[model samples]
Each structure stands twice: as structure tokens, then as C-alpha cells.
Target: MPKAQETVLEINLKALKHNFEYLKSKLNTNTKFLAVVKAFAYGSDACEIAKYLQKLDVDYLAVAYVNEGVALRNAGITKPILVLHPQAVNFKLLIERCLEPSLYNAKILNEFIAVAQQEKQTSYPIHIKFNTGLNRLGFCEKDIDYITSKIAETSSIKISSIFSHLAASEDLNEKEFTLKQIESFKTISKNMIESLGYKPLLHICNTSGILNYPEAHLDMVRSGIGLYGFGNSEKENKNLKPVATLKSIISQIHHIEKGETVGYNRAFKSDGFLKTATLPIGHADGIGRQYGNGNGFVTINNKKALIIGNVCMDMIMVNITNIDCKEGDEVIIFGEKPSASIFAQTVNTISYEVITGVSQRIKRKLV
Candidate 1:
């Protein structure tokens, strides 16, 4: 790739393919793959990513809301899209778009049944979420009878899959907890399958779960961060390639003498003669204010330039006195060498937050 002349996020589909294949290698030959393309494909272009994944023959796609699923449908994505969280108000629109909803509770289940009945639909696909341990969403174990009774009352909707979310599949210390969650899900799925007299697809593993728990791969696996080139651990990260590279160019160079201040609120006072390079990216572009005051650094001409002072809305100044660089020179915020995970670790955050927090206003150059 050429040096960036302006602030741009380079989305490498080749890298995405590599990550996809790598993750697929870990699954059984018969296991299905569900690509989670929510939050704009983790702050990349969701439509483009979904299109590419469709070509790769992904078994299913998932989004967090009805509108997100609708966006994919508008983008010509015809794959089975699972709406991880759908509201009562959008049930009609969801059905119209052929998007499956994850009915987690009695209220949601009843509401969706009403909508499906009103729509005169038959056997519309729906996923049931069980609260094994996440405690965020899904039905309780005791609710299985209620859920089955409700299902028996209606043929308008059918259970397409039963799933759950693992709270900490990445941490080895949480092995016991994760195992319990998996076992609970197995029990729930068993009873539900027996009650329904048929088997719906069973899946509960996320990216970390896919990497850490191969035994729980069940019938399908959902991967979000892994598909975006992160495995949530040092060992697995080595096998994946980052899909997004944030790049920018030096807009201006400032020569600061002793006692000269830089940026808002005079955040930095130079103690000696030095140089600073201002790049056209800041909080507005997802660099965030927490990365300022020497906390964050960018790569310039193969050198590390520490971000000085506070991050402005649209620009950040990095000390480049020791680096051999000039205006219009390429700058790397985070990619390859210093991955997004490494960049985020400087401020005690995670790669998901940093990548997904990237502002949509920034140009995304697909490669």
C-alpha cells in the first residue's frame, strides 16, 4: 500500500479472508460459521464486509439491531441474518426483511409471536437465547416450560437455533465458570430439544470461545473479533492478521522552544527545543482524549512519536524531534507492528473499543 496522503482507514479484505480461513481451520468440517457483522463490522464498512463474507459462503450473518439487519438487506445481502437484539416495535419491519430475531424472554417471545401471527407468516425462523450465566439477556432455565408452552400455542414462528453468550471464554482463570455455562446451555438445549420433538441449531461460542473451547463448538460457532483479526489472546493472535490499518499524514510541523505550550489548555510545555508533527486525526476520529499527554504514540518513518498534550477534535500533535520525518509523511496510528490491541493496552482499553470507536466520518479505503 502507498503512503497515506490523508487520514484514512485501510480495510484489507485479503487479511479478512486470511482470518476467516484461519478460524475456519479450527472448526469441525460439518460445523457452520456465523459471521457477526454488528457495529458496522466492528467500525469497518459492514456492507462491504458482509458482501465479501457472502462470497466466502458464510453460513449466517448476525447484527445487533433490526435496522442493522435491514441495512444489510438493502445492501443486497440475502444470507440468513440473525438479529441478536430486536425490539417489539420493529417486529413488522424485521419480518418484512426476512431477518431472524433472538427471542430471549417471555415479553419478546410473546410480542414477536403476535407480530408473526398478524403478518400471517408460517414457521418464520427465530432463535432462542438462554441465560446460562451472562445474565444480560435470554430466558432462565425455569422459563423452558413457559417457552415450550408458548411455542406449542403457535405455529407462526419456529425455533431456528438455541444460543447463549459466554461471559469470559478468554480467561483461563474463568475456566470453571465457562464450563458451567457451557454445561448449563447443553442441559437447556437438551430439554428444549426433547420438548420441541426436534433439534434446532445449537451455538454459544463467540471468538474467544471458539479459540478456547473446541469441545463446545456444538453445531455452529459465532465469530466477531476473530474475523476482524483478533483472537483475544497472545497465542491465538499470532495466527490471525489485523484487517484494519489506520493511517494518516503529517499536516504540519511545529518547532517548539523551551516553555512553549501545545494544544488546548496548554497541556504540554516544552522543556527544550523539539519538533512536533500534527496529524489530521483526533478524538473525532476515535483516537480519544485519554491517549493524549504521552499516553499514546504513533509510528512515523519507523520511529515512535509520542502524542503530546491533549487530543483535539480533529488533530493530534506528536513529538517527532528525534524522528526523521516531514510534512506529508505517512503516519501509522495502529496496525501490523503495533497492533490495535497493543495500542489499546496503553490506555487500559480493548481492541473492540478502539476499532469500533473509529468515527464513521473517516474515510475507509478498502483494499
Candidate 2:
């Protein structure tokens, strides 16, 4: 509706469906899929993706926080959503919306249980997160008993799933370590479930694990990046389709003589005659400052254009010297060619950050 102009993140729902089917194909018949829709569905539009996923009847959806879950609920998403890092402060809101929370530690488990008891909640679903070497969130191995005690004391909360974060499921060099993590998680989860005398969903695989270690996938798989196309391995990425494609129209083109500088700080000094095309996107739109001074490049008419100088808050200049381009020419930042993974590597990061880092300012159009 905003006119097929300026900067736009073209979202392919068909590709999303395809990726989901591909991942689903790799799992057991009874294995569930929890689509991670946090960070505005990886900065592509959570509301839209959630709606589409709900229509597809995905087993579940996951968000990083309680507020994100509430947003999806507000958007009329009724599918079960797991809040991966729910804080104690949001326990009430989480319970109010019938949203499930991941009880990672004693503090969270007890706090949520107390809230549930106060709200007269019974058999409420809650996930237990174990720290399987990620060292980020989740309860550590020593805290297992603490969680068990809390669950035994509280009859109000029901354990929904026991999950963990993998440290490096994507790296082939870390296969042994990855296996150790999987075994540790499996052993811990089994012990806890048996001790509790109840059955709960078991899941530990993220996008990478779903591809690299299907054996680690027990009952469910929480996929984020895989749903958006880019995989940890080139082989895994083959069947997947990239969901988010960034495109911008060149607003203006300028001829730069030798010695002329471009952009802020004169970071890029033009060498010989050059043509610079200005795109209507920048850091504010998720192209960080790191992608400057020829470090990151984009494609125009299938030709590579080196990003010239520092990326501004609202604009970026590309050296389109040999290309015949003019105002309104389409420029691809990351899509189809080069790929988001290539761009992420250029910034010394991963495609996950690249896609999730895209700011909300850019319009997201679902195709």
C-alpha cells in the first residue's frame, strides 16, 4: 500500500511454508514444530508470520519474551506460544493471557508458581529450560534439584516441555561437543521427567540442530532461522527458501570524479571516475555502520555494487561505476544473490543477527 517504492523487506510466505514443510519432513511423525516468531518474527513482521503459521496449523509458536507473546495474542493468534525468557515481573500478564513461560531457574520457577497459585491457576503449562552449555539462559545442571523441588511443591503449574539451548550445533568441528550437549540434555530431561512421575514435551534442537542433529530432536524442534531460509550448512540451505528479501530503489545517481569523497567522515575516497547510487536505507533500517567503506556490498541488476564510505542513518551510497543504472533502479541489499549469510559474514556475525537486526522502520510486504 505504501507504493512499491523506497526500501522494503519482501516477505515470501510461500517460502516460509516450504521451509516449514522441509523441516517437518525431517522429523518424526509425532514430532512437533515450534516456530520462533520473536523479534517481530525475526524483524520481518510477527503479526503477519504468526497469522500465516496459525493458518498452517503449526504445533506451537515461541517468543523471546512475555510482551511478544501478548502481542501475538492481541493479534488474534490463539496457537500455544512459549515465552523463552519470561521475567518474574510478567508472570501475571503471562498467566492472564494463557501464555506459557519457560521456567529456567528456581527464581523463575518459584516466582511463576507463586503467581499461578495466587491466580488460582491449576494445570497451567510451563516449560523448563536447562542450560546445555549455552551459558545464557536456563537452569544449570546443579539447579535441577531446585527446579524439581519447586515443581513437586506446586500442583498449580504443569510442566509442558523441557528444553535447552545448543552452543554450536552449526559447526561441524564441534560435533563431539554438540553430541555431549545432546546427551547431557537428554539424560537430565529423562531424569527430571521420571522423578516428577509425569510426561512433558522434550525439545532441544534449534534450526541448526534440526538439520545437523535430528537424533537430538526428541519430541519437538524450535526453528527460527531455518524457517527464514538460511541454514548453517550450504547443503541444509538448499531445500530452504529465503523468506526475507530486502530491496530498495535508487533515488539518485551521481558522477564522482577522482579524489572526491563519499558519505560521512569521507570514509571512501573515490578512485577515478565513478558513479554512486544512493539508496533509501541505513543503520536506522538495520544496515549497521559495520557495512561501510566497501566492506559490505549490494547487487544492482545482478551486478555487485560496493558500499562506498560510512553507512548513514537514512542512506547508503553504492559504487555503481560500470553499471548502467539511474534513478528508481532496484537495488538488492541481501536476497537471491550473495545471500544474507554472506552479508552476515562480512559483518563478522551470522545470518540470524542480520535478519533479526533489521529495524521495524522498513516496510514488510508479504508476497
Candidate 3:
């Protein structure tokens, strides 16, 4: 248990190792695994996660930006890190840290090549991102000619991997659309590599693709959420252990008379005499206000407790009338019976958002 002075995020390194091994077991021996530690390792702690993964002999570590890669480097992580969405401004830093930048456009690729040449680098590794269907990033298949031309001129930069993102790999209902995207990537990857006279690693699979579409794991697979547990299917999740277990202590408790209201705006009016537990976490801590008014719940002694009223910035009230507990008792926001998945479902959202949205203000205590 963390000291009462601060709220802490308990990171289960054992669970993380378990999840990693579980995901690795599902992959072919030839398929390289690039653990995506972007967004602070899904808002847990990227540097720490990356360091642990480095020791685990992961094929690669991936971050969303050049700075994220630099953070790992600063933290003594020497493993190769792929910058998934690097920008032109940080091209020098990316080169300096020996981080591979994902070149999505001719402009960025040219800029990076220039930087690599200026730095006297020989064959600096870089990734080409094809916009199969994500639309948010990457170059379209039609732009393959422009990409090939850039790679042809830049002898200092080498294409390390050609990758694309699956827009909806988890949704089996979109099987046709997903297949079309995969085919597009296949066509573009083949044409560009052949034209440039170079063979780079070909990969286009997220967590879902690795699990549901094994054929899509061309040379490498980039997994984020799947490595930390929750799979595309609930049935598949049984093998992946959750790496995070959020716990908070009850700061105070109140025995309210019938008709008494709880929290701001009197959002929760007591039906009868009730016992409420005040937890030390609130919206500021990533328990969003949307979770209030009974929409979200937590576990107290393995029993469900209803959240009442608007979630304050520093506090939230849970109905603990039936629970036999006192102040300083632990109330699990997630991890136990009422898992984060279930809590997110109540508020019409997914577990990813809820877990990643957990504010950095909470100290993460890796176990």
C-alpha cells in the first residue's frame, strides 16, 4: 500500500511479464514484436515499461513521437525504438537518439534524409507508413512513386519497416473492409520495395490483427493494448492478465439520514439511511465526471458500490451502506470483481479511454 499522502497507480510488473509472454506465445517465431509504449505506456509509465521490456529482449519499443523515444534513451533504454508519428522539427533529435522515424510523406522523408546525411549517418533506419484506411496518417498507395523516388535519392536513410494501421481489426463485422485495406497495403509495400531495390520488414497488425488474423503478421507486429491484457475478444482476454490494478483508500464515511443528499447539486438523494464512503480520487485523478450520478461503480470488499453525484476534482462519494468498512479502508476503482472494463461499460465508453485517461498526478508504484 502507498502512503496516504499520495494516490498511487499500482503497476504489476509480474502481470506485465505475464501479458508479454502470453502475447508472444501467440506470435510466430519469425514475427518480431514491437511493443508500443506510447502515451506513457497507456498512461501507466512508458520509461519504466520500456526499461523492463528492454531486459525482456523485446524486438523493439515504439513511441508516438521522437521525444517519447528520447525519454526512453534518457532513462537508459538502449533498445531500438520506432517513432510511430515523428515530425520534421524533431528529425535531428530522432537521428541523434538513433530512433527510427515513421516517414508518412515525401516531405518528412526528404527532411529526415537530409538530417541523416548531415549527421554523417550511414543507412539510418526509418519506417514508411502507408495509409491503408486509418486516414489519420500515412501516405496513400498512389504516393508510393513519390516515396520510391525519395528513397532512391537518399542513400543515407534506409527503410527499416513498411507498416500500416488496421482501422477496425477488432470488429469482425468489418471483415471485408479490413481485408481490402490489407490488400492495399500488400500491393503498395510490394511495389515500393521492389521499385526502390530494397527489402524492408513488412508489418501491418495491431493487437487485434495478431490475435484474429495471424496471416497479417507479415514480418513484425506492433501491439499496445493487447500486451497489457484486454484482447479483441472477451474469450481471448482469459489468457492475458491485466497489468494495472488501481486502488484508492476511503478517506471518510458518513451515515446520512433519510432524504439527505450526497455530493454537489444534490445529485444523489438517499432513499433511506445510508452509509457513504468518500474516496481520495476524483475527475482530476481520471475518474471523469461522467462516471458520477450512479453511472460508475467500484468494489468495496468485493461488493459493488454506486458512485453518487458529480465527481469532484479531488473526491467522489460511493454508497457503502451494505459494506462493513471504515475510513482508511481500500476501495478498488478497478481490478477485483468490478474490473475497469465493466466500469467503463457503465459510462458508455471503452476500457482503453478510462485507463489511459488516468491522470499523471497519481504516482505509479510498479510492483
Q: For residues 1-367, could you state the per-residue lDDT of candidate 1 as single tens digits? A: 7889899999999999999999999999999999999999998999999999999999999999999999999999999999999999999999999999999999999999999999999999999999988889999999999999999999898999999999999999999999999999999999999999999999999999999999999999999999999999999999999999999999999999999999999999999999999999999999999999999999998899999999999999999999998899999998787899999999999999999999999999998
Q: Which stretches of candidate 2 lie over 4 Å from their true place?
A: 1-4
Error of 1 at 314 (Å): 0.4
* Candidate 1 overall lDDT versus native: 0.96
Per-model CA lDDT versus the true structure: 0.96, 0.89, 0.86
For residue 113, give model 3's deviation from the true position in Å. Answer: 2.6
Give, for candidate 3, the lowest lDDT window spanning 10 residues.
1-10
| Count of residue pairs whose backbone atoms collide, per candidate | 0, 0, 0
- Candidate 3 lDDT over 140-192, as tens digits, reads 88888888877777679778899999999999999999999889999998898
Residues forming the 10-long window of minimal summed lDDT in candidate 1: 1-10
TM-score of each: 0.99, 0.96, 0.96
**Tens digit per residue, CA lDDT, model 2, 91-195:** 999999989998877767778888999999988999998888888888877777777887788779888899998999999899999999999998898788778
Candidate 2 global lDDT: 0.89
- Candidate 2, after superposition: displacement of residue 223 in Å? 0.6
Quick one: how many clashes does candidate 1 have?
0
User: Could you tell me the TM-score of candidate 3?
Assistant: 0.96
